[model samples]
Target: MTVEFAGEYFPIQPGGRFVVGREGDLSIDDNLFLHRHFLEIAESGGLWWLANIGARLQATVTDATGGVQAWLAPGARLPLVFATTSVVFSAGPTTYEFTIHSSEPTFRETRREREVEGDSTIGEVPLTLSQKQLLLALAEPLLRRDGTGMSAIPSSADAAARLGWTVTRFNRKLDNVCDKFDRIGVPGMRGGAGGSATNRRARLVEHVIASRLVAKADLTLLDVGETDPADAE
Candidate 1:
């Protein structure tokens, strides 16, 4: 079996194990938010498996049928039931894509029932246009880069100013938004002692992008007539 990501490839020997993370056996150095050893891929009994090794990060696994099989939370493991399985995840502001490949015929059979049945419930959280605008404002820094090559992440006050809102109102609305995500079981969207406000913002953006709750084209909703393209820079 082979694992490929970021123009790099790792081949797994039969009955061998591969660790993936910033400091794992198969180190992915570019993703700063990954745990030292986030995930493990092992070949056992002629079948390949992927396991999340107690990492706070979240992963999405899709089977060969192009249907989502599971969202691997920390310490979760699932079989890779396909000749080629795609895993999509994010570490902080950077998104990562990796693929696992195997020639074994055993991998073609789906053994587990899909666990994404709750996905339909995610859309039940009704969001107002103002709430969505705030989400887009918070996410803009990570999704788009500036010309000067500096991070575009704005302070809460700056983001509030961009939306013509006061800091107090902005923070109140943000809390409400986080509450909505919490009600629906989206990880990293709620504020707790686990991380700082900036970290929460990054994770929120990661989740929104990963779940397709927001998209680049949705930025148009933030625009008023006579908006300047340079402002997005």
Candidate 2:
């Protein structure tokens, strides 16, 4: 991940999987609330967690009638320390912000995008810089955040929030992604049974193309001249 501070973009290459923040349990008076510039996704499909990137959030609590107020600071991880079993999260534009108070405050943010390395089979196809950026941005959230596979169809709301688009706009961008995959002949990159095989193939092609191999037909990997591992026996 890259963080830009004072005109310098520093890459924070995690030695392991990246964890946005730490999580723990807490009592009712300690819930965290926040708001941000982008869209926020409230838990859907029986989920119990939520969070966002570069987001501004405020936390608080309320009584049974939903009348209460307590403001939380931005970018601080607050424990879900409360007794209100029901909590509400409001996700909208930065211009409008809201809050929810409850006895319990634990929310999980699901995946909404994915990342594909350069040097996959799909690396040979051509993609505009913007197209590539949007693709990675959308795919990473789905895989890393939501923890869904390539074949799992995620809700447009999730995609829209991550891409910073309206639901309608997100659907349009998604169509473009699909079309690009089709043009490149990358199968799972087009959204099929995604796994290491498909991901590797697509990423291989994509990497080659992005790096400008120039002669499409002449591109080939150095021969390792080894038997397939599965057949070594």
Candidate 3:
């Protein structure tokens, strides 16, 4: 098996364990928000396992097709069953991602029916074109990134400017989008108790990308504004 980040690859020997974080075998970065040893990958029981060892941070695991996804919370472990497993997470203001390729994967991608309805959605809650534009603005950096690696999440103001919108307009849209997701049982979208708006944006980006709700194809929405209206209501 091999792990990839920024085009560099690290091969994991059979039965060997590898650690990843701010200070681990992968040493994701020197960011203080990242744990010293966040994720551990090991060959156990004739299978590869991905475990979350960090107390504060969580990782998003998905298959190569992004059709299957799981949240790896602290102490959680998942089998590396897919031919390629992509891991994504956020630490502080930056988001990092990497891919794990297994030479002997147990599971393979096949046609699967859509579990949720709508062209873009969460639990049947469809995303408006305007909301999609907001997401594209926020996710532009990550979409433009070269490979599996770290990218800086744009601030609300920066994202707003990218959409050719005023801060007030941008903030209002952001509030609406967050509120929509929050109502649909999505966590970390609310402020005050959950986290600050800054943290919320990072979580939003992490979830959307991990779930394949937004892709590079959606980035073009920025060029042509959403016709849905200022107030989607």
Candidate 4:
């Protein structure tokens, strides 16, 4: 198996293991928010498994196309089943990503894109144009990034400013979007009535990318800026 990050690749022998974190076989950034040894990649039972060794952080695992996803929380592990598996996680205000390449993959993508029926339903999650714009603002940096480099998820205020709106307006729109996602049972989206604000932005972005809820094509919304929901129709 091989790991790709920032245009660099590292091959992992079946007998050996690779560690990813602030300091490990693959040393990441110097951010104090990250664990010294966070994620562990090892071969078990003839399959490569990616495990989250950290107690706080969780990883978003998906196929290269982002059609399938799995959350790898602490103490949980997932097998690298795709030919190219991508893992995304958030540490502090920054989001990090990496890709695992297996010479022999157990699954391959065979599904193709179908026509859209009505509102913007990204993976069956209906989104309004305004909500889509909100997501584009939150996901702009991540969308612009290439390879496996770390990207900072903008703060709500920053994202609001990016969209030329007041913080209150941004938060309102955020609540609406989160509510829609919760209705469809998207995990970690945010529970109604009592939901903490911490990590909500990061988790949203992580899930959006890993679940293929948003893609680069949506980044054009950032340039279009804020718009009326009716105008997009």
lDDT of every model, 2 decimals: 0.71, 0.34, 0.83, 0.80
The residue-by-residue lDDT of candidate 2 on 1-233, one tens digit each, is 23222233333232312222222111112223322232122333333222333355432322222322233334533332223321222222111112223223344334645768666654344544334434444344222322232333235576446545577765565556556655755343454463543343334333322222222232121112224442111
Candidate number achieving the greatest TM-score relative to the actual structure:
3
Give me the candidate number with maximum lDDT. 3
Order of the predicted models by TM-score, top scorer first: 3, 4, 1, 2
Error of 2 at 135 (Å): 2.0
State the local distance difference test value for candidate 1. 0.71
Candidate 1 structure quality by residue, lDDT tens digits, 1-233: 88887567888888889998888767766556778888899866656789998558878776545434468888888876678776767676555657788777454454875667454644366767777778888777655542111135577898889888889888888888888887877677767675468777766765665555666678887765324442322
Total residue pair clashes for candidate 3: 0
Using all chains and alpha carbons, the TM-scores for the candidates as numbered come to 0.59, 0.25, 0.81, 0.79
Better of 1 and 3 by TM-score: 3
What lDDT is reached at residue 231 by model 1? 30
Tell me the tens digit of each residue's lDDT in model 3 across 1-233.
Answer: 99999888999899899999988889978989999999999988888999999999988999877778899999999999998999988787677889999888899667767668656544555777778888988888888874333347778899888977888888888888888788877788888854487778877887788878888887877888456554343
lDDT of 3: 0.83
